[model samples]
Target chain A: MNFDFTDDQQAIKRTAHDFLADRLKPDKRRELAEAGSYDDGFWNEIAELGWPGIFIEEDHGGQGLGAVELVILQEELGYALAPTPFFSNAAAGFLIQQAGSDEQKERWLPGIASGEARGTVGVVSNGEAVLVPDADSAAVIVLVDGESASAVEAGSAEVESRDTIDSTRRFSRVSANGGGEQLGGDVQAGLDRAEIALAAELVGISQWALETAVAYAKERKQFDRPIGAYQAVAHRCAQMMLETEGARSAVYYAGWTADNEPDTTPLAASMAKAYAADAGWRVTASSLQVHGGIGFTWEHDLHFFLKRARTDGHLLGSARSHRDRVAELAGLSRAAATA
Target chain B: MDLTLSPQEQAFRDELREWLEKNNPGQEPSGEQDMFKFRREWQKTLHDAGYAGLSWPKEYGGRGATLIEQAIFNEEMARQKAPGLANVLGLVMGGPVVIAHGTPEQKERFLTPILSAEEIWCQGFSEPESGSDLASLKTRAVKSNGGWNITGQKVWTTYAHEAKWCMLVARTDPDAPKHKGLTYFLMDMEQEGVQVRPLVQITGESEFNEIFMEDAYVPDENVVGEPGQGWNVAITTLMNERAGLAFGSAVAVKLALGDLMDLVRERGLEEDPIIRQRVGQLYIEAETLRLNAYRGLTSQMKHGIPGPEGSLPKWQWSDINQALTELAMDIRGPEAPTVDERWTYRFLRARANSIEGGTTEILKNIIAERVLGLPRMR
Candidate 1:
């Protein structure tokens, strides 16, 4: 059976990519990132492009597409390094659509799609990683507790800046103080959705990192040969390709699980998110090495990708956490068997 | 981005899965003769079912389906524990080359029977003198009349005794550079001077054969390409050989895993955390392979042929197999030293998996030199 992007899907993905390319320039990305102006304007741009709406219903001013569209959107954002609230708002907006009441969606979903409001989900009460399109600037924060969730307004929370390897994501420590509206149902399900979304984001980042590395390797020459012509570098690029591919597969399985197999989504997301986190870090590291010394400098374009990779490497859950999650799933199965 | 199948493809997958769910080649008796008959019959059945030539054009009696369909067929085939394909030389190499590089007459002569399973073709490579140094082989196919006289020994020929044809590579020029002198030929294995003797392997079965030739004759019509350009032609065959689906881990597939588990369980060793951990480790390796397969599939779906990234899975798989077998054999305790134990059978089989398609060392070299951009060792 065919396991490929449909023509319509491809067309939409092309449109999103073109939209990103047309709207964001390299200088603007640099300027915004420098100012740390991760804000509502960029969020508005993506929301206006109907990205946040892809998972939302048509009546809620959304596109009503599924996990496939979500992937296309994240990949485009990654391609641009757009410094937008796309990842933050879209993912949180998706959660709202999932567990929020009809009244909750009616009140916030439209504002999210229209850029009047933005949101993000923090499965970890406190995390040090900065690995999304933009996280610190979101207006609303969805926090998960076991199988339950609470939506805390960012402006109301007492926050502390955390030590971070990646500056682009700009994460913070927050004290929710039990001061928020709880999401519907158990906290574990909500945490699963949030983790899976982060995994999808990492998949996009890893893919983009691999492509950039390959292109860079092909262009940068040494000793009368393109670095890519050398097996050490070429194999790094190849391994990056392999990891990106692997991440993509894992993300897809997780994405599919997210939409259909919600009960198994946690296990699948753990696998996907864990693999993506590790792979993204690897591809980014390999890209930097392939770039050589120039990649280490902030002036070079390579650090930008590397920074995001470093940020995302520990976001949502680190590779170890996801591995533990997998172990937990296995543990559950064994215990259930004995019972 | 989307993973859903079209109605037709879904129907095809369902039909194919239903077919595979019932038919299994592993059920064939382990005897080489019995296996050969089973293989021929299975190929015929696949042909009759229009499942042959999965990626070939329809006129060649193939299904002429998309690459994914071919992938599905291969995946399902592997899943069903089918025998290694009977028509690989034809289906994977011959069919592709004939379509891309073959003469019209060659296609007309070879295409149908290949899909029909009428002729089982074996690969003639890996001479005793030229294992990793295949380019330096001295297999000479000298021009005598309108044809050629091939004088060489081809060792490690898989089932050549049962095969009707051989895809042979020989040195057409003794004076040229090592790679420059090579030529590719699709020769009749049943011809005079062609002697195929099955080598009783360490497994106590002669599954593969060695061919000895003394001035064996081949008509000019069978020549794959220009006489001096055989090296280039041979590269095409090698490239085709290098290309195939990634199985990731030998222990990953459910049946394979189950069988491995049964071995551990039958030995009453299930309580061993080390055994459980080893199984878990094998599963992760398999999952890694599965991830690589998906990545390659995603690339193919969204971009193009997955390229060298596809090779990493197999390379890692073989390395892990060698390790896994060593571990399994270790767990089997003292009974594993010789062929006295079933685990040793797996150890031997694992050894062959690396050597057969490509050796672990060569694959590592390829990954390093070609994929990684590392300098090659002299």
Candidate 2:
């Protein structure tokens, strides 16, 4: 019943933390965000580390580590706020691996795994999957409409750039028809894993924001005392810890379930996603409130976290939708029926 | 992180489960004394099977269970809706304190009866005035003929009427500082100087009591640790209270939530979008509490004490349980306020969840000043 990372997992986390710290400095990340593009050098370095395929099967030209390892990387990357295609590519990788046909796996899984041909998954609505991250650069785009999924080559889809409030990553509007083979297996299971990945990222963002807020509260004094001594600011920080830890607990559990307890993954994934989406945005916003005026300025780095949190909360699914799923899956439907 | 138990832990759990199944005492009688007697008998049954004092070391007449086993024990007990042991305060706090700091004779005198439920114990830490600022308590014990004469009032004393021993803390040095002058004494509750008056709560139950200790006698041997070190001993008791309660509290909340879900389904509200969202949110909150508790338990096992996150589960449990009841009422719709249901009573009971343990506001202050490194307000 240990709820701690293993020694090997800790090593992976430390490696990711150190690499991102060294490579994705604040100025570098800001520059990439401003350009609305990922640096090829940074992308190539991450690819060299075999991070994209950290969770893909070993026989599929990649590492066979599970979702726990994948989340470690995603969380570190989120903390760094690095402008890379790691998340979108990993989202695509999850769908292809979990839901793709054997033929589709042979065609795209190798490239996605090796980071040679990066991929992204878009949730299709109204014949277009808007806000599809890295669609312009993605080689394969898996457009998901409900339980059905189809992998569309970037060349065959009409991809238009979609600017968003969060510049740390790029998004695109993609529409494809009469192209790309439909995923033959369970699309919902694949999406559940994807949602778990997003949830992990949200947890990371909240953790970063919380640390930043705590650091600021300790140093930023008012009335000849650190404002944190006042219950107003202090309580806010405490509440942030509560929310962050709550999201973290759910995310970590869901990540473990994805790898070890597949039968429980669907419900666990939705719960994690629902809790984290709200926590990710709320904690950062509260952190901003603690910082007060300086946090409102573009010059401060807190806004970046705030924007990322807001964006992540609505990425694959809103908290409301996930909560509804949780309601159904966690036994509310039966209760209501009997009622 | 592996959330599943190992083979050894699973074996321990299965064995405990089998024993519970075989020796299950069923429900307690309705009367207060009858319930207490029933619970004492149940504790005796547990003691005979070596299920009591699961966290104490083997040398101290306990199973010497690992932290995981202790957690599993709490979870299973909550799952089974087992009756609480008659000497809960002793098992959780008093025995541990004695083992940690008492003389060898004190352990011999106190530990076994606590396990067997032969001598029930209750806490006498809070007073009407001291409450959250326990060190500021005015309960004073003066030097008498080779013993101390304790004279003061203690409020919120649970099980005072049924208790044979009261784990009482009082001011031993009138001239010493508020926190430095105290002493912890194992006072005999079955004495003329001791009085226990039931303090009826909003729930219309006398679960707690107000005690007036008029020159209660306590020999020097009964003092825990040293004189003038009661604050530290009390802190240990409080920490133990918070750390050990999280898992049991989480399981209890989950059990309540399961019942509420049944109510939701019974009301045919599961198909309602708004109701579904609220229900789902509660489920997420409850699951988060459960997971965070396990994480906190793991941290405590590694570090020998709970981290700041350990302070969380109680606060979260209070909120989640309260919300579950409120949602049950909401699901009941126009019939919500009707006393025809169990949730109305549960909803009122949950109001004390935050206030009883430690006020939610006080918990925030602890997290801020101690955990977050915030400067103290001078």
Q: What is each predicted model's overall lDDT from 0 to 1?
A: 0.70, 0.89
Model 2 misses residue B123 by how many Å? Answer: 0.5
What is the per-residue lDDT of model 1 for residues A140-248, given as tens digits with 9 covering 90 to 100? 7776654566777767655565545555566666657777787774456545556666666677677777777777777787887777666667656656776776676
Model 2, C-alpha of A313: deviation from truth (Å) = 0.8
Question: TM-scores across all candidates?
Answer: 0.82, 0.98
Distance from true position, residue B8, model 1, in Å?
3.1
Model 1 docking grade: incorrect
Highest-DockQ candidate:
2
Q: Candidate 1 — what's its lDDT?
A: 0.70
Tens digits of per-residue lDDT, candidate 2, A1-339, equal: 899899999999999999999998899888888888789988889989999889988888889998999888888888888888889989998999989988898889899888989999999998888789899999999999988999999799999998899999888899896577899888988898889888888888898999998899889987787788889998999999999888888988999999999999999999989999999999999999999899999888888888998998898899999999888888776554755
- Sorted into a CAPRI-style docking class, model 2 comes out as high
